[model samples]
Target: MAEGGQIDTDILSDEAFDVLCSMCKNQGKNTEGEQYCVDCKDYFCVSCVKVHSKVPLCAGHKVLDKSQIKSRTSKGLPRAPTERCDRHSHKHIDMYCQKHDTVGCSTCMAVDHRLCKDTFYIPEFIQNNTYQVVATREIQTKLKALDTILAEKADRFKQDKQRLLKRKAEILADIRKFRQEINDHLDKLEKSSINEIEDKVKSLEDKIKDSLKQLQANKSRITSINDKLTSTNTNQSEVFVYVKMAEDAATVAYKYIDDSELQCTTEDIEYQPDITIPTQLEEKKTLGTLAKKHTKTSVSLFQI
Candidate 1:
């Protein structure tokens, strides 16, 4: 098991080790893994190793003691059976054919790949194609750079959305404040015009009240003269004098009331509420974009 309790496929399990040793089980008394036959790609018990060494064909095969066998895999790849070919049963894959981009055994090289332009032993091929290994590492580097670029762009986009939302709130607040200022200014103008109209009307009302009071006093004087003349208790000359004085006062007061300019109208000083958003805030553009491209390369793993 791995660190997280997940099964690690690269390590050989007990059951798999038992299965590999089964090939030598018939010849062995003690069936416990003690050695690995590299050529046969199998595990062998102690008795099985003695028998395998005696055979002429198996004698040439490479053997490893259990303690000498490496357990961990390389580059996360399971320990590949490099001693045998996948296509040919028990045949060793020692030749690499550059023309076909594949590794094959002796029979495969003699038949289908005899006319191939370039061929070499697997060890020589790997030694000669170090450039291909470098190229693969370069590709990994490029991909890692792309990962960083994508992560940064994603973070920038997230920040852009957040910033735009915050800026919208700020602009809304400014607009509301401007609207309130406009309303307040209009309120001030309306109140001033209304006060002026009220003052004009009040002044005209006071003047009218004063004129009525004077007319009432003149009527009282005229009535007093009539009562004296009818009762024969006053002189006719004094009654004529009272009538003349009342007539002069009446004509002047009536003319002044009719001629005085005491009217007020809101048509000249009416307040209006009209506001338009300024030019800078009216722009319609939202945001921008970025573009990236990938190019093809002419390189092959088999080419050195």
Candidate 2:
């Protein structure tokens, strides 16, 4: 009876190991795992190893003996046969939620799939032979499709990144070009304004110099007339003529001075900048509006 119990335990262990072995599980075969493939991260029975060795894809795979597996296990490495939940690392995945079309742990079932209508214990679900056939076909098909989608998405992402980088460079170039255009325009305007100011100053200076020359000439004439009037040898008629000439010269000088004062009035030049340019620039948030265009393309994978 004790030997029979031992036999039964070994059979159960073999069955459990087969469940964890990719080769045995997929082939729907019952086999006791004897070796571990390091590269594949899977256990293989003697028969499975023979099959694995025959496959060209398994050429470089490294296999370890039971002793090595035991040694690794002793060093805290988990022995293959138990599939752990990705979300709950401490818990094993043993339940399936059909509604969500996902396999998860007991904790996942309790926390996430509690309200799901079609949840099942995986071990019990797998007892139905139809489940294996359907799962194998559908899962394999979906996995292949997902792989294709992933590859396409990766390519698209690369293309998009390149396109965006190119667009960014173009935008920066355009902005710099626009700024250069503005600088060029401002430089031209500055040169023109400076020339205008210089012309105005030159004109004003010329008028003041001309007025000064005239005033000086009038002063000289008046001085000469006064000197003639003071002469002792001059007669009364001559003196009266000299005095009249002096009065007329003084009147002309005063009138010229009054006229010159109006013409040579000291005034400063001032510049008023247009407030709108800077005010609008400060209020502006962006150079231009960024817009998104939606385009749709349909893809058919594994149509047949």
In terms of lDDT, which candidate is strongest? 2
Each model's lDDT comes to: 0.42, 0.46
Q: Which residue pairs show collisions in model 2? A: none
lDDT of 1 at 260: 30
Instruction: Say which candidate scores most in TM-score.
Output: 2
After the best TM-score superposition of candidate 2, give how far the Cα of residue 248 lies from its true spot, in angstroms: 99
Give one digit per residue, the lDDT tens place, for model 2 in 1-304.
0010011121122212222466777788766678887546687887788788788877645565554443222222222213455677755455556675566666777788667766654433443213323333343343334334334443543443344334444444444444444434344434444454445445544644565466557656655555554452223223323333455555676676567546432322222333343335444433333322222222211010
- The per-residue C-alpha lDDT of model 1 at residue 46 equals 76
Task: Residues 1-304, candidate 1: write the lDDT tens digits.
Answer: 1111111233432232333364456555446667777566677777778888899888656565665454423421122224455467665555556566555665677677777756554433332344233333343343334334434433433443343334334433433454455433333433443354345334434543554454445444444433433343132222222232334433443343344323211111112222432332233121111112111221110100
Off by over 4 Å in 1: 1-131, 182-304
Q: Residue 253 of candidate 1: its Cα lDDT?
A: 38
